[model samples]
Target: MKNILLIIIGTIMLLSCQRDDTEQIRIKTKELISTHFMGNGVQWSAYPHGDTENGEWGKLMTSEKWEMNFKRLDYMKPKLFRVLDQANWRYMVGFDSDGEPILDFHTPEVKAVEKILSYAQKNNITVLFGEWGTPYKMHDLDAGNSDKFKGANDPKWIRSIVAYLDYLIVKKGYTCIKYYNLVNEPNGDWASTKGDFEEWAEGVRMLTAALREKGLDKYISVAGPDAVTRYDNPNSTYSGAGWVRETAKQLDEMVGIYEVHDYTEYDLVRSGGFKKYHGDIAQLMAHTNKQIIFGELGFSRNGVENQERASRDLYACEDSQFDVFKFSYGVDMADAVIQSMNAGYSGAAAWALDDAMHTCGDLGNKNELKRWGMWNSLGTELCQNPADENMRPWFYSWSLLCRYFPSGCSVVKTDSTGIEGLRLTAGVYNDDITVAIVNNSGVDNTISLNIPTHKQLKKFLYFDGDRAVDVNRFPIPVEEKIDAKHSIELTMPASSFVILTSLDY
Candidate 1:
């Protein structure tokens, strides 16, 4: 009888300890980083090919296809519309050999610009008019003289650009234009020397003064240096953060916004030194008051993973397989955005909104060239014929950020442990809290977000090798409510993107 009672007591104690362990939960606290975000923006560069039938823009401007694209854009709710002033063929449409006043806006590109501006105005999106380079006339004495180009610092170039801006805003009545980027990637070829930066600054000052004289200054602000390469490289005199600092010191308030294009595939978060890069850039905030924006960002089409093989099974022309490589590309891009914002950037823009119908560059041309569009503008030659304007996996991947932490939401910091190969970004939409997790590891994960036990886990969406789908819509529930101990567990698939929200707003 004594032995029987001892055995029973031991078993009871074991059961009780097990119960206590189950009741214990992980607790996490998150705090806000910023009060507001400047909203998401996209470029309206040559979206549709210039060609008539298959091209996306000009010929199909009024067609059902174009309408569908805009409908999709409307869903994204883009805050800023960066417009390209230079079109495919020439510097501008109206330049003549006689050097007459060049205000003619009759070409397809000009018409496209007008249409885009009108659409943006209707949607209340700010327009950032950007010039890719000096006009052909300003650079070349004759139309075909590529070698006879004058440098960007020339006074004649400045005057001509200002004249063009005056024509676009004051003369043509594009009153909706809000921002102006003087030249895209000037450090690449246009302006290199510290003196050159000063010249560029002077040009901006003259241009703003001209616009103010025309009474359009109130409508348009200026952003500059549009450096294409890294702005923080120490070895190079004209590249990296050193270059940006020198340029900013020269420009001062001539330009209120400092911008750059990031085509960084080599330096990714996975490489382990990306945080230091952001930290270095953030250090620049101490010197200048200019708001920094990564205006254009994308990974190379011929990415480091692999690109030599041809994709056999998919739609359109044969190209690289849309599997892990594309998935990784999207994941890396998400990290760049997160890090950029975390480092105090105002906002970031994807390199492009849509991929082109045809391959662009000669040297880099392939059967299915990488034009860096969110959607693949596949031609009608492949298995899924007439896929001229179909969305790619990236469209879904990017929508994760667009859907959850929208513009005006405040960024927050979250603490966690035991989660590997995962990046979490949180934002507060008034009283509602949103947490986004991007999982790059090849294994599925069960995450326990430590928060208030009283709050209910409202909704969630996830994307893994697919478009973002609502978790609640699935047969199985993916999000669990916080238990009495204040722990909410979530199961995230490998290479997935998840967004979780609290029930109460």
Candidate 2:
């Protein structure tokens, strides 16, 4: 009886030791994914999404507010920016006596554009500038509009927009406008093209010809098809992936860069389904020699229901996600970024930079502001709450990504450790390296990262209660210098991520 009791105790001890060892051992193998890391950033539109009557954009542009916002942007260090605008907002005013479009480059709206572009120019940021849709129309079925531009393909619209591009790129010397997106999400019925692929293609061709004719093609190339995924149209069966494949097959030559938008659900991102979903699309454009990017990336929980709930809670627009207020959104978004980089996407721009940039219907109503921004710049004027203007939790993780995974960095992938909901992506820029690890599972994970670099790394943690922020709300490194010559082991808490970078600042 004594011998049997001792043997049982020894077996239990051995099993417990094995279990602990298994929990502590997670060796990740790093591999080179791509040498070209185009960039990562946010959609920073010119002018507020609402009208100027509400003082949305105006208040945000004030000396004090502008300086504060500039400081935040400076710290984020975004290398790619998408500036989407409406035609009537800036140069396109009205048609002339002969029905020709009238252009004005000196309006306040244009000045707002200059503010955005000037910063992009100064900071070497790649600007993907574009129009939302047709100048004065949302849906094709709408009537009572006197705008002469028939559709995106309208010869008049194409010529007018190209002239506007000439003023900015050639005349104003804002050479940072590297690509021009003709229309936003032409695959959707809500767009002016009304999911008419041929119509949108014709417009793209016309715009491309106009750019070439005006010699602007040398400076800026056309980027499309700016489609979005999971767009449910009861009347049509078209999908964003279908749009991309067709664009690759049909409008291959006219397009310089292929791009799309995705508002994925939490399960897709957390379960690593986003990698396969995006990888299939990335494969479509592989032969084109031009890189593909997510022009607008975001999250929506249960689609319209989730957005409506967010609207009720915030008393804002209906098409926004409440998850932006949660730390989980940051973890999920980081997961998406990891998947995107691993899936062969060149880059991704977050849905928006500020909630003040748009309203639900562009009606200028303060109450209708979209709630998908890093922060609301006009929160004080619109929501009467200054706290709404502060950076949300996602900014910590995202800004770390934007600052460290800069343009021209080589994106490195890693072999999976068979750990559910744990992901790793690295970027190497010359001697500097940035490694991001995200744990999306409900349980904690102990990961051993094997990165082959001798540089000292700055570790930034974005857990629920452990985020370190400075006075400016920018992410401060938890550890200033972590020696990365050997394997680095750390515990990644549930719904959290960590960034290890050699680049400081």
Best by TM-score: 2
User: What root-mean-square deviation over C-alphas does model 2 reach?
Assistant: 3.8
What residue pairs are clashing in model 2? 49-357, 51-364, 153-203
The local distance difference test score of each candidate is: 0.56, 0.81
| Model 1's TM-score against the true structure | 0.75
Task: Please list the residue runs of candidate 1 whose C-alpha ends up more than 4 Å from where it truly belongs after superposition.
Answer: 1-32, 47-62, 87-91, 94-101, 137-149, 154-160, 163-176, 189-199, 229-237, 301-325, 357-370, 381-385, 416-420, 450-460, 465-486, 502-505
Can you give the TM-score per candidate against the true fold?
Answer: 0.75, 0.91
lDDT tens per residue, model 1, 285-370? 54775567777766544543344333442321332323323556666666666666656666667767754433432111324444
Q: How many residue pairs collide in each prediction?
A: 9, 3
